[model samples]
Target: MHIHENRPGVLTALNQIFAEQGVNIAAQYLQTSARMGYVVIDIEADGDVAEKALLAMKAIPGTIRARLLY
Candidate 1:
């Protein structure tokens, strides 16, 4: 997944959401520049639940977009 946000609390919020959805983040990668931050998260979840979780992630404040990579 890709998360576009540069502010604090974005990752924490995402973690909370994932926890609520019963998804476990297996791995993650973060890259930040002066203007933005991008996070790629590898999660373990059921297919249906993963879709819902991605949509929830997209709805988070400061998140420009969210999508599954595979």
Candidate 2:
């Protein structure tokens, strides 16, 4: 996901949604440029939960993009 600058609680909100959906985050990485924040998360979930989590992440206010790579 790519987030807008100075957006507090974005990561927390994403994590909350994942937890609410019962998705387990196995690993994560975060990077930021002058104007954008990037996050890559590896998660584990049964059936459609991963897709659900991606949908939830996409719904976040500052998310620029959220998609499954594999």
Candidate 3:
């Protein structure tokens, strides 16, 4: 998992979650504004991990949204 956040620790949390699930992120894009943050993850679509990862990130603090791109 990857995340774009102006606040610290959000990205690290996402990375840890992905690692625990054995998901390999191929590419990622992260952008932030004073108001919110955005995250896009590109990964090999092999299982439900993408969906789970998105859900996990979406549940985290400071995350406005999460999406998986195949």
Candidate 4:
């Protein structure tokens, strides 16, 4: 995930998103400014399902960007 730039409330938005999908975040790091930043979430999810979830995250307006790190 990355900052939406125009949108605010990154953490709250993600927390709600995760709750909605029953995503379990093992670890996470987030830093954002007025423009952009990065979010890394270590999650417990099956491979294929996780990829699909990642795509869904990208589809969210405030997310702007989402990726599953190695």
Clash count list over all predictions: 0, 0, 0, 0
Instruction: Please give the CA lDDT of all the candidate structures.
Output: 0.82, 0.77, 0.70, 0.69
RMSD of 1: 1.2
Off by more than 4 A, model 2: 1-6
Each prediction's TM-score versus the true structure: 0.88, 0.83, 0.70, 0.70
Highest TM-score, which number? Answer: 1
Instruction: Give the per-residue lDDT of model 3 (tens digit) for 11-41.
Output: 7888777788888877767777775666666
Highest lDDT scorer: 1
Q: What TM-score does structure 2 among the candidates reach?
A: 0.83
Off by over 4 Å in 1: none
Q: List the residue pairs that clash in candidate 1.
A: none
Task: Rank by lDDT, highest first.
Answer: 1, 2, 3, 4
Q: After aligning candidate 1 to the native by TM-score, how far in Å is the CA of 5 from where it should be? A: 2.6
For model 1 the TM-score comes to: 0.88
Greater-TM-score candidate between 1 and 3: 1
Q: Where does candidate 4 stray beyond 4 Å?
A: 1-3, 62-64
Q: How many backbone clashes does candidate 2 have?
A: 0
Model 2's lDDT to the true fold? 0.77
Error of 3 at 18 (Å): 1.1
